[model samples]
Target: MAHNEKLALLIVLPSLLAGCTSAQMNMLTGKRNKTYNDVNAPWVGSTEEQLISKWGPPKKSYTLESGAKIISYEDMWGPISAYHVCVEKFMIEKGIVTKWGISNCPTRIKGSLPKDTPIPQPTL
Candidate 1:
């Protein structure tokens, strides 16, 4: 390859590699970095009321055509933040928690709960 081409590759290669490394790290430690305050272990059967009582209020929620409900919560870390900032989702069906997951980070979703939605006081 030409000298200029080699030089360009040298500069770009590190950035490309860094991006890949960051993605891999997120996949590996994503769940461990989540912050769950309300519901306890073995979350499969926990009810929506139980979750609200523990984690205050969710940032957003939705109801699907199949009647399943999804509630999301965010962990805000003040001003400075990192990839560790995350949003967690709880799947509820028939008044019972069925599944849950954590995303790499949080993002605003259109039509989400209004900013004024009341966050329930923590019961603990």
Candidate 2:
């Protein structure tokens, strides 16, 4: 690769890594919050049954053709307050979780709803 290209990568890569680290720290410290579900509370390592017990039933649950379990939780953001959906894909193998992911998620979900405004009912 050209010298300029290599130099740019060296500068850009560290900046990108630093940005991600800061975001992660903010998330952990609650300095930055993600409005999906609850910023103070997020999905953690727990059994499917435990999750259900706490969050109540998910909006949608399905087994993929490959047998992955996908559970969707509906949340919202903004004044006109468009509906926002947060789906966590659980990778279960042999009845145990292998991994999970947040799909199509933004860096943050913001809302201006009243404190008394109930969480939107999931239309799943």
Write model 1 residue lDDT over 1-124, tens digit each, in one string. Answer: 9999999999998787676643354454442222242232246688888888888788999999999998888775436644355677888899888887766543322222223433222221
Q: Model 1 TM-score?
A: 0.48
Query: After superposition, which runs of candidate 1 have C-alpha atoms over 4 Å from their true positions?
Result: 1-41, 78-84, 105-124
Report residue 23 deviation for candidate 2 (angstroms).
9.9
Estimate, for each residue in 66-124, the C-alpha lDDT of model 2 and write its tens digit: 87676656654334556555464544443444455554445555533334434322122
Candidate 2 lDDT (Cα, whole model)?
0.53
lDDT of each: 0.62, 0.53
Q: Report per-prediction Cα RMSD to one decimal.
A: 13.7, 14.9
Worst 10 residues of 1 by lDDT: 31-40
lDDT of 1 at 30: 48
Candidate 2 clashing pairs? none
